[model samples]
Target chain A: MFSMTIIAILMVVVMFVGLYLKSSPVLQEKSFWQLLSSSEWKPMKGEFGFLPFVAGTLWVTLISILIALPVSLLTAVYITEYAKPYIKRLVFPILDILAALPSVIFGVWGVLVIVPWISQHVAPHFMDFSTGYTVFAAGIVLGVMVIPLLVSLFIEVFSSVSTDLRECSLSLGATRWQTVRKVIFRQTFSGIIAATVLAVSRAMGETIAVLMVCGCVIGIPTGILDPCYPIPALIANNYGEMLSMPMYEAALMFAALILFVVVLFFNLLSRIILYRLEKRLG
Target chain B: MRISKSKKISEEIAKVCMCLAMLIVFGFVFSVLWTIFSKGMKAMSWDMVSKLPGGGFYIGKEGGFLNAIVGSLYIVGASTLIGLLISIPVVFFLNVYLKKGSKVAYLARLAFDVLFGVPSIVYGAFGFTIMIFFGLRTSLLGGIIVITLLIIPIFIRTMDEATRNFPRDILDASFALGATRLETLKVVLRQIAPGIATATLLSVGRAIGDAASVMFTAGYTDSIPTSLSQPAATLPLAVFFQLQSPIPEVVDRAYAAALVLTVIVLALSITGRFITNRFSKNKV
Candidate 1:
């Protein structure tokens, strides 16, 4: 009975907090709107706008997903449908350990190695730009960070396709590629899309690595080679310097709300897609 | 026969490519491990582990990470234990007592989902705001609260999975023997105790590696925490500080600290896997 009451109270608290944050007068005020719309993000002057940060986040997330999704899907397909057992055993654990590496190390590596290499070589050759810290660089690093997740998810989805399906396709004189494309891809389309969305969300929420590489500039990035500030980076950069009570509270609330929504949407979507896939596959 | 030859060629190429991909992945992992080990091992002597970080910039000469190490242990230990205590019971209540398709269960699951996705930084902000408002700023207790909140969702989801995976026949057999509901739970459900413990250990792995959540809430202090109310530095915080410093020694110390943190997480993961394997074998 006590446990039930506690669960009930916790449930009520969750809804209450969610609703209050959604409907708070502080969030709805004209000043809050003005603050959110303005492009200036000076904490000392108490000017805060989320526009550039949000745009940066969207741009980086889009770029990272574009890079990660294709490579990961191809890698997954190759491993699941084409690779031998010995190769699969060797490859899968490597990906797992890569996924488990701490984000801080990634951040340090980005700062020390990736940024310099890009500045010296890649950026200069590609865009005639000599800078290391750019949206493109950060997005690439983010792609690397999220690749393991996408690979693992797609591998699971692909491997779930029945051996009988593959055998039947092969028996009909279809090539391995044809079997994968005709059978496995068609079957796991929804799961793949869900995994892509989940990967996008992970890239969006990434903080330390992006902060190290993204240069943290507060403006719309006109080119992929330009620097930009992501939402999480902005929050990490400004939280300590926020002087006004309202500004600080509002920034925290806004960052929390944005993160909450992005993460929640992907989590629910992934869960739903996986549930449907499980039901159908089982 | 022609088709088989062509198929063999393509299969061989694909296998080669897969092998190369795996090599690339391992190459990245080994590069990272080498970087950390080469720099970290040189600095991580017994004296370094036993002393505290000095106020000055000298790393090898002045002080060590004794306080941060102890504080990490204290904070992660306390928070993970508390989180497991609360979450296991809640997971049990939801999985066992609540009927399927019940409104309460639905809401409970929803709450868990939301909590799981909530950013660790937001938890840090919330804990910071609440603790400051309650005059508990920069305190170990504040850090514990924040870490506990961060781990709760993880523990709940893990324990929930473990419970759902528990065999129903065991429960039925106990009940068939005329055991009470609680007694049946103790006998049948408790048989999966090691699995549940493994889940909680995974939670600890997550908590120990977390940096952003504890950054604001913990409010780093160089000194050892003598009381729950005192502020303390964790290994992550120490690493962060060292990374930000201009001194070479300090940077090396940061690498050492990172290595320590990584080893701890690796150890936890291995132990969790061992326990899980042992549990599965026992069940079989």
Candidate 2:
């Protein structure tokens, strides 16, 4: 039993070591900073710059969090604090279905609906002759994808606020809204931050839906409407054909390593915050 | 009186905003489902499931995604079995053998949490690395290995949660009866059978829908794989590759494929809930 537990814990270390070993070829050729900061991504020319992809990832994650946070928070609040009992039952199935839907299916939906809508309606308002496959399109689709997750997490966080405090606030001449804002929000503030951090991490690593809509181009997107490629898309789109160049395989592995590390960091941070929150609340 | 009136108005505004947000969320869900169902129904055909891709399949000619269907079943089935085998033991170890709140258990849980958060793409890349080291090409075996790794954390975590909720008195009761640890494990397993079922269903749902991890490792094929060494196609990959075609028929077929995947996932979720509710009544 102890050995089994050790094996489970060792999985994380094994992943990091294996990825680093595979990525060492590229890391040996260029410093980590150079690889990240440079914008050149000519694989054939052996220049692998990750700046554009990283920037694109950040842009999509930011846009998604921006769109998802408020909607999910408000919706969760409505369901938990305002709605009738039957409403919770109604809302939960929707969240479950959305959560169960595959990313590729979401990609197909984005391609058929969101892309065209953006190309005709939203993108033209911002830029000239957009193909609708831009960071913004990916962001919007990704935003929708993350909404169920955020809403679920937010619901959990909101519910964790004790009813006694809510009663205390209400009995002190506060309205329902006032109690929610002051007592509930105050109690769950760190929990909300942790949920957003976790969602941001999720949005960062999402591939297929974002890859389909994000244009998969190599340039840095200066605006949301511009076509851009993210790191996960870059790795996914290139790795199959990367055999001809040894460094290319290593470079893609390095990209994977980057995602693994960053996601691991965020997960760790959120876990720490959540653990502290749990301890405090207990 | 003026202050009270202002507060009332503010409350009304907040409620209105919350309702609007809910409306937007529901709107998106319905639109997505409607699009997939409408497009999928248009392209649904008998050939789509019964036969493999024939000549000129990608050009909207005579071919279906039987290859992907069988391949997905093959991969997901094998991986789930392997995942269950490994996950059951680890979860038992966590909840049964170790003291509650032990540092090792906490670290293991934390590790699984991080692993769960890691994207499928990274797993693909790591799997690819392993394949290269082993001099293995893309094949069904590669896909199974990678997917098993991908889902172990999910299985362990879900079951761990269930195992943690297990009543301590049950273990004490078995111990007082002079039952061995292995014998007592049976009781606990019986207690968490619903949890195991839920975990398996959720992991299978995730593993089947995944495209990126299997993209490089599984290696799509035109026909269903007859051996572990052979490349296999998956429905998600089918949707991905078919949607990229310029032909409208092919693109419609992508929606058809998406619809198929959605139905399978929704079915799994429904049955999972049903099974949990059914079995949970027997739990202590």
Candidate 3:
């Protein structure tokens, strides 16, 4: 039995080992700081700077979380505080189905629906909007994807708030708005923060859906309307041809390593916050 | 009167804000499903699942995605089975064999959390590098290995939560009877059987829908693989490659493929719910 647990833990080590071995050459050949600081990412030209992709990743994640946060918070509060019992039952299944819907379908939807709609109606108003595939479009798609996760996590937090607290506030003549803002939100602040961290980590490493609509360009996008590649998209778009150039595969492997570390860091941070929050709540 | 009116106004504002947010999400979900079904219905046919792709399939020539459907089944089925085989024992060890709050147990739990959050694309990258180092190519075996790794965290955590819900008095009862830890495990396993089922199903839903991790590891093919050495095509990959084509027919087929994937995932999730409910009666 102990052996089984040990073997399962060893699985993570195997993945890290594979990443380390694959990315080692790139780390040695190109200085880590140069790779992190430079913007040039032409694989065929042997330039493997990843700074732009990092910027693109942070840009999209920031935009997505910004768009998603208010909506998720509101939806969660509405469900917990305002929704009737039968309404909650009706809403749960939709959320579950939405959560299970594949990202590729989201990609398809983004390409067919969001892309054209943005290009025709929304993009032309901007000064330099080039195509349908913009960081903003990808961010919106990611916002849709991340909303369910945040809402669900927030629902857990909201549901776990003690009824006694709500009653105390209400008996003191607090309005629904006042009770939620003053009591429920304050009680679940740490959990809400943790959910935000986890959701951003999710948007950061998202690949296929983001890849489909990110336009696959390698550059520091000047604006949300410009096409650009996030780190995962850079990897997904180029891994097929990475073998075509010397160290190209290793460079992409290093990109993957960077993605791994960034996501891992956020996940760990979220877990720590969640642990502390649980301790407090308990 | 002014303060009371102001509070009422604020409450109404909050209500409107939440309603708008819910409406936006509802619209998003509605449009995505409507598009897939409308397009998928047009392109879907009986032969799409019953036959393999033929010549010039890329150009909307004759053929079907039978290969991908079968290959997805094989890979997801095998990997889910293996993930269960490993996951059940690990969960049992954690809950029954180890002391509560032990470092090993904490580390194991934390490891699975990070693993669950690790992106599928990284798994693809890791799997590709492993293949290179081993002097191997993308094959069905590679897909199974990577996918098994991909879902291990999910498998472990679901079962861990389920096993955590196991009653301590039951364990104490068994041990008081002079039962060995191994025997106590059998009793506990029976207690969480439904969770084991739910975990396996949830992981299956996830494994079948994921494409990024399998993109590099499971080399695409037009036919069902005859052995572990052969590469397999998956539904998500099929949808991806087909959707990129300029042809309308191929693009429609991609929607049809997406519909297929969505249906499979929905069915699995519903099944998971039923099993979870079934076990809720036994929950301690």
Candidate 4:
């Protein structure tokens, strides 16, 4: 049993090492900074500039975080701090159902509904013609995908604020909204930050759904309407065909490594904050 | 008077905002469920589930996704079994063998937390690298191995949360009697049976729904895999691959596949709720 615990700890290191080893050829070919900063990505030509994909990932994740944060925070607050008990009970199952739906399903839905809607209605309002498959569309769908996760995590965080605090605030002439704003939000502020960080990490690494909607193009997206490729999408779309090119696998592996390290860093930061929060709350 | 009136109005406004947020979320959920059910039900048929992808299936021909259904069940079943074997002891060790607040336990929990966040795509790349190193082709076995890795952290974390809530006095009482540590561990396991059920539920949902991790590792096939070494298909991949087809019928078939996957997940979640409720009632 003790050995098993040790193995669990080592597994993280092993994964990092394995990915690094596989990606070393690409790293040796060009500097890590060069790979990240350049925009060119012709695999057959052996030019592996990852800037476009990195920028795409940031764009989609940022838009998603922007879209999800407010709605989730507000909804979670309403559920835990404002809504009646029965409402909480009814809403939770729906969230779980939404969460359980596969990413591919979300992708399919985006393809069927969002892409066409944007191409027809939203894009026409602003531009002459646009395919609905853009970072904006991916962001909207990803935002919806992350809502259940954010709301659930936020609910847990809000629940950690004791009932006594709410009562105390209310007794001091604070309205329900004021109590929530001043007491509940203030109390769970760090936890909310942690939850957001975790969600951002998730959005950054999410594949397939984003791949289906983001148009999977090669260039950096200059606008929300433009097609873009994300790192995870790049890795997923190209891995099988990458064998034909000499360093293609290595390049994809390096993209994975970058994603792994970035997400790992955020998760570690959030976990530490959450651990401290848990201990303090306890 | 003006300040207090303004405060009261602001409170009402805030309440309205929160309710609007709730409405928006509920709206999205309703739309997704409606879209999938309405679209998928139209395409759903007996042949979709019962028959294999016949010739020219992708080109709007007569065939179903039996390959993906059987392949999904095969991969998810074996992966869940393997993941449970690896995660159970580690969860038990974390909750039972280690002292509370121990540095090792803390580090292990942190590691699992990070692992839980690592994307499935990373797991796919890592698995692909290992498969290449061994000169192995993508097969059901590869899918099983990678998914086990992908889900172990989920299993451990869910079970660990349950185990952490377990009463320590129960362990001391068991030990005060004639029970050995192993026997006491069994006692602890029974106490947290609901947690185990919940863990299984979550891991199974994740494993079955996952496509990216197995995308490169599983190597999709048109026929069900008869051997561990053979490539297999899965429902999520089926939805994704079929949707890519230019043909409208094939795309509708993608909805059918999504419906199947969604139904399986919904059924699992409901069954899991029932099992957990049943187990939890037995607890003191």
Which regions of candidate 3 deviate over 4 angstroms?
B1-3
Determine which window of 10 residues in candidate 1 chain B has minimal summed lDDT.
B17-26
Give the per-residue lDDT of model 4 (tens digit) for B30-59.
888788999999999999999999998888
Q: Is the docking of candidate 4 incorrect, acceptable, medium or high quality?
A: medium
Task: Give the CA lDDT, 0 to 100, for residue B20 in model 3.
Answer: 97
Q: Please, what are the lDDT tens digits per residue for candidate 3 over residues B235-271?
A: 9999999999999988887988888998898898888
Q: What are the lDDT figures for the candidates, one per model?
A: 0.74, 0.90, 0.87, 0.90
**Tens digit of per-residue lDDT, candidate 1, span A1-282:** 436436634742553365345325446653656755678766456456777888899888988887677667778887887778887757755665566666666676666667888889787767766568888878877887788989988887887778888899989987887687789889889999888877887788777678778988889888787899988777666556543566556665676567666776787787678657855885
What tens digits encode model 4's per-residue C-alpha lDDT throughout A148-233? 98998898888887888889988888888889889888877899999999999999989989999999988889999998899999
Ranking by lDDT: 2, 4, 3, 1
Q: How close is candidate 1 to the true structure, as a TM-score?
A: 0.88
Across residues A1-282, which tens digit of lDDT does each residue of candidate 3 receive? 787777767867777777878888889887889999998767767788888899999888988998999989999999999999988877777777788777788899899898898888888887645678989889988988988889998997887788899999988899988999999999988889989999998899888999999887878988888887899988887777887764988898998988888888888888777766766775
Record all residue pairs in model 4 with backbone atoms less than 3 Å apart, i.e. clashing.
none
| Weakest 10 consecutive residues of candidate 3 chain A by summed lDDT | A273-282
**CAPRI grade of model 2:** medium
Residue pairs in clash, model 3: none
TM-scores of chain A across candidates:
0.88, 0.97, 0.95, 0.98
In angstroms and one decimal each, the interface RMSD of every candidate reads 3.9, 1.5, 1.7, 1.5
List, for all models, the DockQ compared with the true complex. Answer: 0.34, 0.73, 0.68, 0.74
